[model samples]
Target: MSEIRTYADNRQPLDRNWLHKQWRHLRLWRRFLLQAVVRETHYRAHFATTLLVGLVQLGLGIVPILLLFGFTQEVHGWSRAEVITLVGAYQIITGLMAAFVAPNLQRMTEYIAEGELDGVLLRPVSSQLYLTLRWINVAELSNVASGIAVLVIGLVQSGASPNVPQLLQAFVLAVCGLALLSTVWSAMSFLAFWLQSVNPIGFIYLNLVEAGRYPLVFFPVPVRAFLTFAFPVAFATTYPVQALAGDLGWTPVAGGIALSVVAVTLVRMLWRRGLRSYASASS
Candidate 1:
């Protein structure tokens, strides 16, 4: 009777633990998203230049895509319109970075350096969440607008309009692409914990991401295989754009999604493990 009672008590705690974990994930996502709303209210009143500069940068970035169709019918196997749509999807990721992930993560390194991250360790919420949600950038919305314009132009150029089914498929791939790109960015930023300097590392990763602008096909098989399998920018950039261009079928999309999930999950685990090594200057 005592043993059975003990088992029941143990199982009760296990059930509560499961619920706690579920609630934690939900809370984390909610907090992160809500931070954007708070940031927007703060920025619109305090920092109008942030919005203006973001718009200017976004415009410069989109010029190549926006005017590409007029310059040439196509580049390599990708039409000017198709490449623009791909660029649009890529720009959505850029917007997210300029607006949220990059700015926050960069600030996080400061927290780590100054010992502020130690306070986060005492919070009921995860230290990672605290750091990630510490601030928001309001300028990223410009990238979103620019991306949409490029997408519209690309669709018009595709000659045959995408039906609803086709559009839905493209969206699914685009979302996955966004997630994959964010995953790469986060993983690289988190490497600051181990290396103690992120400026050099972050610049390297940014340059690599820039390479995604060109079609993967232009690269030889060895490089293509390396990026697609060894690194994963191909999944984040190449496949989704190709899907929009109608060059990739469902298989490549599925492959990209699967690779993204596996890579991001692994990176999350690694980041947490690295956190154990974090010893802030303050605490």
Candidate 2:
């Protein structure tokens, strides 16, 4: 009985410590996000230009789909509305990544290059959390807004209104998709530890992500399978859009969840190894 009580007591403190640590991270991230918003507001002209550019990009992106639909009623059994939904999902996911993930990874690379990362490493918080939460490009929210607008339009035009359960599943899948992208982004950014320039690598990743804008159905069976299983671009756009458009089924969703878990585990291991390789100038 005494041993049981002691074990229980010990577990309580560990659980409390974990919760406390999580709270601290949340507070820190909020502060950092607020700072980023304020900093962007100070650059009014730049923000305006970014907003304009994002809107223009959104408009231009729809052009190819429009042209394709004009030529044919459906591309690979995907009607015009379904394609729009996919595009909208792509925009939302990509816009969010630009708003959050890409900028942070780019900064991480810069920090690694300039040796400024030494200060970040010395901080009491998790270096990964700090690195990711330290920056934001508020102008990219314009893209987010544009994406939301496009998504609403697509959903209406599709006339395939998902029920509550399907909508929830789509949301969950979308989050998983973001996690997968972040995993890939982190793995690529880790390369900065060994290389002087990772822009070319980043470019490749960006283009690959861009490919997800079109329906995976357009690709050959082998290519589609590779994208779905190997790279997971299909999860990022196609699957989530399908979920919203109607039945996505459970198999793909389960696969995506499993992939996210495995990817995150691998990314953490790689990140730790990269940290060990880091030669901090401050040290």
Candidate 3:
């Protein structure tokens, strides 16, 4: 009884310590987001201009789909509404990437090139977390809202009243899509450690992500395989839209979740390897 009591007491401290750490992390994240909000709102005119430009860009993105559908009622059995939903999903994913991931990726390149990463390394928190979450483009969040509006419009137009289960699946798939894209972006950013100038790679990556706005069925088998596995951008937009339509099967959903997990793990491993090879500016 005494031994069991001792074990329980020891475990209690461990559990409390873990919870405390989590609370601290949450607080730090909140503080960072708040700072971002303040910084973004400081320049009100600039914020409005950027927001307007973003909305215009999003609106223009839909034009291509409209033109394509105007020529054909359906492309590979994907109706206009379905295609619009895919585009909306693409917009949402890209908005998230721009707001959260792109700024950090650009900064990471600068840090690596200028050896400014040393300051980040000295911080007590995880350097990756600090670097990635330190900045938020609050202005770009409006694009996410616009994307949501587009998605709803498409769903309503298509007359797709997804049941609760289908909606839940779509939500889960959307999260997985975001996670998968984030990991891919991180992997690309890690290339900065070696190349220092990854502009070409970044350009190619952006183009590939743009392709996600369309269904995979439009591509040839080889290209489909590549998009499904090598890059997996289809998981970001196509799969989620299909889930909304109740057309996605459990196997693909499971595969998407598993792929996201694997991608995250691989990217983390790549980050560690890059750090090992990182020659600090100070060094």
Candidate 4:
């Protein structure tokens, strides 16, 4: 009770000490990552298998794009190079999701269902942060490398040499996009609080992620609007590629950042609300 009260009271203030708190949290995260790495390294064959599967998946993802481009020069104003760039960006985002976000959220759903979260809630640290960062899928990192390679190929094919500012803009937008995706996953996983099964929900979310691989213009105006404002799938893949291709402006970047902030805040609140409804196994 005292530790919980101390944590709650500390949350009331955002001062210089907040940075120190965050630094501590970061150190904790580093330790967790290191431990996960050590555990992953113990299974060399499994790691190799995951790497092979990731490459196979990457190749499969690119095949349709190549086939489509062969039929037409462009799809809804997106050139072959731009489309490839979008796929590359989508690969990177999904790689991060698979590695860092999805595995944690999937486990979180199980934790909530099985009441394993009781242990996490008793910890002195932030439960949400701890839950999200406790595990690392180190083997999935190969997909990130594959995405980078694909992104470079797309850029080279496009013949666009992005400047430092463009690269920085793309990086920021990518981060924002990732933040949005993570929040969405968190929000969906939190549904385990009310629902008996969340696996289907998670499957639906993965299907939605596939939509991020294409140009937003390919969809209807309603979907384009939804992908931009409501769901913001385009922010993850399209906007970043646009930024990389020097086609994006400051407005979209600002919007992406703002939306990410709002999404994360809302999901954090949702997590707290979900916790209040959580019933432990003993209950």
Candidate 3 lDDT over 1-283, as tens digits, reads: 3644344334334225767867777788899889989998788887798779988988889999999999999989899999888878888889888888777776777788889899989875668777777778878888888899899999999988898878878888888888887888778878999998665667777888888888999999999998888888888888889989988777888998899889988988998999999998767
Q: By TM-score, who's the top model here?
A: 4
Cα-based lDDT at residue 38, candidate 4:
95
lDDT by residue (28-72, candidate 4, tens digit) is 889988987998989999889988998998889989999999999
List where candidate 3 sits over 4 angstroms from the true fold: 1-22
Assess every candidate by TM-score.
0.79, 0.91, 0.90, 0.93
Candidate lDDT values, in order: 0.68, 0.83, 0.84, 0.86
**lDDT, model 2:** 0.83
| Residue range with the least summed lDDT across 10 consecutive positions in model 2 | 6-15
How close to the true structure is residue 74 of candidate 2, measured as C-alpha lDDT?
Answer: 90
Q: How close is candidate 1 to the true structure, as a TM-score?
A: 0.79
Rank by TM-score (best first): 4, 2, 3, 1
Tell me the lDDT of candidate 1.
0.68
